[model samples]
Target: MSKSGNPTLIIASFFSIYVIWGSTYLLNKIAVTELPPFMLASIRFTTAGVLIFILAKFLGINLAISRKQFLNTVIAGFLFLTFGNGVVVWALRYVDSGFAALEISAQPLIVLLLMRILQGKKIKLMSMIGVILGIIGVYLLVSQKAIINQENSIAGMIMIFMCMLSWAYGSLFVSKADLPSNYFVNTGYQMVTGGILLLLTSFIFGETWTSPMVWSTPVQYTMILLIVFGSIVAFTSFNYLLKVVSPEKVATSTYVNPIIALTLGWYFLNENITVQSMIAAVVLLTGVYFINTKKKLLIFSRFSGRLSKKLK
Candidate 1:
């Protein structure tokens, strides 16, 4: 348990990320069936961003940001949301939501390797083992004949992997970039900017747009849930957890989210959860655990602790 904050709040925060974020895959899958992907993401983030600013005002948090910080937020927004999330939503049209979630679960592995390549950081022996296992797991997951045989499945998988790279690079950039001191304010800026960019992308791609009133009932409900819970509430909890708990502990969401996604996809969407995917998920999550596990690296602990505090 974390040494700070109420235990109940901490538990609730964990639940938000573990379950709410996990369920987003299913919700998005449902929505994208009826709505255009980029347009859907644009509306969700824009609405959520506006709502966040309203909440911040109610809380009396400062929203002023420097130009440099604004630029950083835009860059982060593009990498994390515009490209990273928007493309994934688009790809969901071609791939199962569970499979997409499972593939994204390898993000930790991507981040670890990115740190090594970009920052010249040394990978510990345990992390090296994790890298090997992650590669094998990914191979197992993507190599299955059933998945590859599906139309556009290969394209979807490839694009999702590219989005992971974008997200991984964005993670590295944010660790050093200057941004709003308040996490809520910072996230609001990112959401707004990212959403705007997504809207532009939608226009460029000639995606059809429709009013919320005309949307199907399920899509309407999904959009509301996505904006309220997935983007705002869950993200707030994620930032809160980073402040109160060790990141490795917060990262337990990585393990639980895909399980929730897989089960929900199977139950609600009738998406297949093949035996190979299950095996890959286990191996991949195990590798993520190994990569996140620490052994008294005082320097990293101090750095991450400071980063977490500053991020809030």
Candidate 2:
């Protein structure tokens, strides 16, 4: 491929990640209807883990790891998939898919803050401003419902936010840990470890499984497709994009996911998308763009460039 093709590939890969992942929130909502929350998440990761491992094996990918690396990978799985995505799946029971997406979309902000506090890195002022704006946007999204219903969907939202932090931590671990060079191999390990842990937790929590012969048959198939396409294909392609694309472009996926989730929720579940929700989306996207593209903010970028370089 020509050098020029590289950017195009990156852009395309990013679009894929954004659009595909955005839809997963609705997928979770649908899948959870037929499957118990924990079991549903457990099955999705396990299937993805098994499939990815088989594919990696077929492609001559190595799965072996040092004792330290193995432990790190397992711990990573617990943090990332277990705590991050697992909580989102768990919360879908209590929130709309669109709402669930908006809540979890707080991820970039959480990641930014976590990196600063945990890693002793400084956040760019513009990024900090962006986080503030994004938080405000989230507040707007739920403000009316909060006032009208007097319910604390705040707890559910906080769970998803924590999901973001755990995911960020797991990602940091992946970057810093001593693991095999092959990305697929490492991912397979993480998936297997994470999936098994989720399964064990499901058992401990008494999650029951049902046969395929159910009216909500789509849920089972949805979970399968989600694991196969969403977890495996979308995520692996995301890694490919990060390798080839500018971080700014890849980060755009964070903004795009809410749109995808909202549209999918509308189509599949007959969910309503209100004007206020659209406003919330705009605010969230703007905030995320600001946070992720702090380089464009000039002075703040200069101050935080060293820290940015380390996180990236």
**Top model number, lDDT:** 1
Q: Please give, for residues 1-312, the per-residue lDDT of candidate 1 as tens digits.
A: 333777998889899989999999999999999999999999999899999999999999989999999999899889978999999999999999999989988888888788788888889877887878889889999999999999999999999999989977876676567777687898899899999999999999999999999998999999999999999888767656655665446656878889999999999999989889989998998888878877534556788899999999
Displacement of residue 144 (Cα, Å) in model 1 is 1.1
Residue 136 accuracy (lDDT) in model 1: 89
lDDT of 2 by residue, 1-312 (tens): 111226675666676688878888988988877678777777777778788889878888777878987887788778867777787888787678987777667677766776688787788767877888898888888775642363545666667777877866665555556664565766677778888888888888888877656637677678777888788877666655534443334556777788788888888898778788778878877888788874568756575887889899
Candidate 2 displacement at residue 297 in angstroms:
1.6
What C-alpha lDDT does candidate 2 achieve relative to the native structure?
0.74
TM-score of each: 0.88, 0.85
What is the C-alpha local distance difference test score of each model?
0.87, 0.74
Model 1, TM vs. native: 0.88
